[model samples]
Target: MITIKDLNKNFGKKEVLKNINLKIEKQDHIALIGYNGSGKTTLIKLILDLLTTKKGKIEINNLNIKDNKFNLKNICYISNENDLPENMRVVTYVDYILKLTLGRENKLTELSELFNFDIYSSTLIRDLSTGMRQKLKICTSLCFEQDLYIFDEITSGLDPVSKTKLINYINTELITKTVIYCSHILEEIVEVCSKAIILNQKQISDVITINDKDKFINQYNQSFDIGDLNHE
Candidate 1:
């Protein structure tokens, strides 16, 4: 479980996030949705300790994130950023990540097969297409068991078919893990997450359950223009 209280982050004179508080319980799959400057990424960075928390507290599983003993071994974070090494082969890179995280290849082959990445296992990271790289990233990260999973724009460069496969894989395999999914894709959000947190004006404006699709869509359109969100 994760608990954030009175979190406020500012960069110089600009206020990025204000008075943000949230609690994520185990087995909760959440969608963190917002406009471009709505501070979604800032909040996530704060949670991940990438940004210094000047005004609030963040605790994961009862341990303060600011504590010196805090660790992220039980948390798996995946972003769209090009952080993977370009020179490593697909399987080698996955093996390296496994060695660091799980210390063993738990479901490594299964995940590769799920994303249809086995065909390119011997290919170098630089040679794979954008979608293949994304798949490789997901396969490597999700292969291990984790208490919390944070995905940021994971389906950004994926094709329709690949996106569907990733979403299905998450819904099927990661249903019990605490997940925070950040994306601009509306339909996929509704499909993958049970709860949607709407950020607007540097704060959490709403937290709605995904049960009512039309109601959630209308609420989202009201807070942030529907045109800015991807519905397909």
Candidate 2:
């Protein structure tokens, strides 16, 4: 389980997050949702230990996040930005990632078929369109079966059909892993995650679950029961 206790973040004189405490259990697919500049990325960076925190504790299982004692192989992360190698071909890049994860090239073929996107083995990464690069990035992450998957705005450049297909693939593949999905696309969030954490005003405003399609209706304050989010 991932434990966050009294977690807080600040930037210069601005406080980004305030006293955040939440328990992320196995198989918990949480959607971290907020408008722009709500400290969403900052929070994720903190969880990944990309930034140092001084106020509170974040731990995976029993090991503190700052301690860096946990096995990194258990984590698979997808960044929202375009960070793939520039000079490599799409298929070549995927193949390289496959080697690192001990995955097969056929998995790329499968993802290509699923997303309806062509994977030209000779096409350079710089030449691919935004949506194509996004598809390739997603395929890179799919090559692994890591225990914890963290996705940040993964659906940004995907077309509507491709987005739906990717969501379906995630639903089918990661049925039992711990996932943290961050996106401003509410509909996309509802499709991929069971619970949605609304971050606002440097704090978690509500923890909502997908009780219905499109409308993630929650008529009550969920601040009291983070553990029961999936049940709702």
TM-score of each: 0.92, 0.87
Across residues 121-231, which tens digit of lDDT does each residue of candidate 2 receive? 689999888888888888767777778888898887789888888788779889888889998665677678888888878898887767765356432233433233332
Candidate 1 lDDT tens digits, 1-232: 8999999988999998999999999999999998888898888888888889679999998999878788976788888888889998877876677667655464877777777777337888898887878888888788768889999999978888888988987898888788999998888888899999999899999898888678778877777777876656
Identify the leading candidate in terms of lDDT. Answer: 1
TM-score of 2: 0.87
RMSD of each: 1.9, 4.9
TM match of model 1 to true structure: 0.92
lDDT of 1 at 191: 86
> For candidate 2, what's the RMSD?
4.9
lDDT of 2 at 62: 79
Clashes per model (N, Cα, C within 3 A): 0, 0
lDDT, each prediction: 0.84, 0.79
Off by over 4 Å in 1: 101-106, 119-122
